[model samples]
Target: MTDIHIQPRPVVHQLRAFTPDLPDRTVGELRRLLGLDEVIKLSFNESPYGPSPRVVAALQQAARYVNFYYDPEGRELRDKLAAHYGVGSDYIFLANGADEAITLIAQAYLAPGDEAVIPALTFGTCAFATRLVGAQPVFVPVRQDLAIDLAAMAQAVTPRTKLVYLCNPNNPTGIMIDGSELRRFVAGLPQHIIVLIDEAYAEFVTDPAYLSGMALMPNHANIVTVRTFSKIYGMAALRLGYGIARPELVAMINRVRNPFNVNFLAHVAALAALADTDFHRLVAARNAEQRQRLTEAFTERGWQVCPSQTNFLFADTGQDSAAFCLALARRGIIIRPGHGWQLPSFVRITVGSPEQNDKLLAALRELNGQ
Candidate 1:
């Protein structure tokens, strides 16, 4: 008799069975669906202005080194960032992007059945990373003003809580928590739980009362601050970001993170961009000006615009935000619908150049019939 052999089929359980329910691609797919060229994308919060001239030059020069492997330690870039932030290189860990840093933190610290507290209206990456590590995400709702409800967050912390994510000048909402309130909240938390502060948009902030997690890092061993060159630095394509924490914490993250996560061009570009102080100032000033212009325009149109301390505005249209976004897309304007953040009536618009902002306002006015 011939011996029979059977191959085992892959088993899918509830934990690994879930598929991502991403919305149909807005800009990329919309361009193909409508057969259009030159689509204006304000959907993703990318810098409207490209990278600094110095960064571009450095990228071009660094292209020659593409054949060689990048430095595994990223020592030069880390030293530059350390000097820029007035911290020691031991306190820093570089990642491909701030998003990757979030994932690394979760992998290093979180265990299955652990809890990570996040704002309900946060960037999806924060929540996704927490879940990827088999940790549950406890979403605390925002206040009526659309800012993080610190009181609720304080109450949400339990014995099993491992991480608490706070996005200053938060994504989607573009609002910030006051320094005093944040300080009180952080002080109240148990020292065992780590507070992950995402400050990707910190450079664009104008409020002096807004606390930088970096400023608080010296006092809290469990606090980790993440910054990126993606937004105001205008190097999203370069994908360079760094984290500051206690040396021990940084070491754990480095151990779990991939070696050579940052490419040669990105490393050089970030270093160049950091040295370009004038470019940084220009981008910050332009974003502030455009943010004010967009806020006033939305207010005059009877839409309620949340006060933004970031590079974007969250405007609550009286009508459905998804419908408004679709209508705006038909006119070649791409704004982000807030459905992903469970904000059905709000849309996020990135601060663009004067001409772009004017064009967006005009489009909104036409749509609202004002």
Candidate 2:
């Protein structure tokens, strides 16, 4: 082998245009890094209950046939979803994850110089996808309650604003806009602005004011709701999600979709998870109870925990978030820091099992020097 000096090839301008904000590491990697035997994984809003027993059985049975490719169109899942939402299969578009739907929508609707209006505490993926298409993201600051400031967002839209990103029970902040307010917001927006509502935590929402975007899509052609089985269903490892829109929009986004985007095992798991309504209810109830408990505990201690409808709580720790997360990691717990979101004094903590929550509280108490 000769010593060769070669120049590194630069990535394309589209890729270089923006840096994607995604988790670059895994729980196992972090555990290995800290030389810990086990780490409580609560950084992501995942179901600590895991999926239903049916999903496990179905996946176990499907494991024998890992060599086969799943249906490229994901018809079975799409048909079931269509019926679930009272829509035709043509109105549904499946993808590897909800993030993929966001990307496809941006690709289909956005061109260079276009704009996507989003909240200041917008989900990370929505911003990343918008930037990926070389479109400008016009972010409107949230209200004092940490909910999306829809009026501000509506005012920010112009002729060039192609998309509006709305995250129900938004990530990081975990606050949601009410149904009536959101409808009024949409009504005020220019018809040209397509709304991409990311509803990853929809299943966990117990608030009466919350509404599913899919329920409002029948009359509105501009509405696109992205959902996933990764949260309440505990199938994050499977990477399965979909976009619910009118037939015209689904057709348009489908053009950018890759063939066989959803894997066979994932398709099976999601299918099984749907039929497990009891399991779903159980997880939702547990999350709601735990979320309330955590919020009350934090509030009593003079911490500002935002009211959360999702399976997570965004708390003002009154400390350096990065330092707090590092401390938690060293104590065999994984959590999210808000440095990326520019809230250095805050952290987003996912509601976990009772034991996990207790362990987390203990860690917080120690960090408070109590």
Candidate 3:
């Protein structure tokens, strides 16, 4: 037989498999092992309050239409989002999730030798997407305060730089850049560079100084704002996210977007979720109260807690995070260890419902012998 060998692109060699920061044991397994009544999961920054009742009703009603193909354009959801963001419907690009939107952006705009400026410790997906398209990901380290160093990121841009990625209220640290600083940074960048801002946690932010990247799209043709329904809307399982940009840029990205990437149920859920604004408002209010309570609790315990405007809190427990998380897991509490982000002293805890928070605090207090 003649030898026939095929090889993947060299960029494939640089890729590493992603391992989620979760406990080895399932919630059920942990409950049995620990003889516990409940296993409180505080990872992934998911909404403690599940989706709105309207979303549930919408999905139940939508279940009947599963036999039919979903709208390829996702026009209904896009129209809802456009009206909410005060943009034309043509400027919206819906994807399976914000993660897919990012990858699609890379596919559309990046080529071999292209460079993407990314924050060193934000979300890993941005870097992964950049590498998927054979582009170099230039990592700019966060500032000492753990904020995205916009100036340093701007300095990293060069003639080959085609994209810049930012994550507000950065994961693992929860630090955000101020609105003025972000505006200044974007304004200073070259007009040709595509600026992609991942605002997955935008809806949870209560800080007045924080600004949505979508607000900047009118003036900056190169700016792309990617948002998700997974966070505040409690649609994580539904997998619906969208990007806002100039109509031209959206059209370009749409070229790479798979047809019917978003399913019918997700569209229905998202539209219903949008109309049920009161539910989100209540969730946000609860999150705000719990977020502050958790912050104070961590601070009172001498743990260094970051001021987070998101649904999760990042804290340095002054111990190995893996060990810390494991200790908590033994008591039927699950959280994300920061070892994956190279910060072994920290952990990310998702703010949960009041009862869940009470249990977590009690467990922590017991662990500390308080």
Candidate 4:
């Protein structure tokens, strides 16, 4: 038999595999290895409180309709979202997740020799997607305080630049860019460049100065905003995310989107979740409370905690983050080590339920011999 061989793209050889915080196999393995009945997970920036009862009920109701494909265009949910934001339905495009939406934007707008501007320490997806599409990702370093340096990013732009990606209440570092600053940044960019902002954690924000990227859409034709139901709605498993842009941009993105990108159950569940504003408020309020508690606890230990408007907290532990995370995992708690993000002494902790938070704090205390 001849050995099978096929030529793959050069970029595929250079790509780094995505490292999820908690793989499913790791969950079971951890339980067995640690002799624990259960393990607490606070690694993925997921909501400690699961999806609203309404989402569950909606999924249950839609279970019988699995035989039929959902609306290929995701019109119902798209229209609902548009109405919610007082935009035309044509302004929205639904994808498997906001991550997919980011990739889709890259696919539709980028090509070889094009360049994308991304923050050095923000969500890895932005850089990953940029590279996946064979475009150069120009990484601009964040400010000393770990906030995005919009001015520096602006200065980095050149004739080759085609896209700019931003993650608000940015992942790992958990610092949000002020709205006014973002407005100026987008406004000053040449009309040829498209600015894609990932606001996956926008719902978790409590800061008054923070602004949604959608607010810039009316004035800036180059603005595209991606949001996900995975965070505050607690629907990570559903993989429902949507993007908002002008009708023309959405149409271009739709060309690369799979017709049935979002499943029926996810569509109905998102619709149900949207209507449950009370549950939304409840989760946001509780997250703020727990976030404050965790901040104080980390500060008490003399660790430097980045001020966060998101559900996760990023802190410099003054120790090896990977080793610290491993120590916590052995004690049946899971968190994200920052080594992958190039912060060897930092870790990103999702604000979990009170009991889960207690477990994490106690594990840290033990590890430090406090």
Considering every candidate listed, which one attains the maximal TM-score?
4
Per-prediction tally of clashes = 0, 0, 0, 0
Candidate 4 lDDT score relative to the true structure:
0.90
Root-mean-square deviation of each candidate, in angstroms? 3.6, 2.9, 2.1, 1.5
Candidate 2 local distance difference test against the native:
0.86
C-alpha positional error of residue 153 in candidate 1 after TM-score superposition, expressed in Å: 0.6
Q: Estimate, for each residue in 1-370, the C-alpha lDDT of model 3 and write its tens digit.
A: 9777888788898998765335545567667877888898888788889999999999999999899998899888889899998989999999988999999999999999999999898988889999999899999998877788888998899999999999887776777779999999999999899999999988888999998888788789999999999999999888988999999999999999998899999999999999999999999999999999999999998999988999999998998989778889878789888887888898899999999999899989888993
lDDT of 3 at 105: 95
Output the lDDT of residue 154, model 4: 99
Model 3: lDDT of residue 208 = 96
lDDT of 1 by residue, 214-272 (tens): 77777778999999988988888778888999899999998899998988888888889
Evaluate model 1: give its lDDT. 0.85
- Order of quality (TM-score): 4, 3, 2, 1
List runs of model 3 lying over 4 Å from the truth.
1-5, 21-37
For residue 84, model 2's alpha carbon misses the true position, in angstroms, by 1.4
- How accurate locally, in lDDT, is each candidate? 0.85, 0.86, 0.89, 0.90
> For residues 1-370, what per-residue lDDT tens digits would candidate 4 score against the true structure?
9987997899998797754444223567768877888898788888889999998988898999999987899888988999999999999999998889999999999998999999898887777888898999999999999999999999999999999989997987889999899988998999989999999999989999998989988888999999999999999988988999999999999999999889999999999999999999999999999999999999999999999999999999998888778878878898887777788999888899998898888888898794
The regions of model 2 sitting more than 4 angstroms off are 1-24
TM-scores, all candidates, are: 0.92, 0.93, 0.96, 0.97
Better of 1 and 2 by TM-score: 2
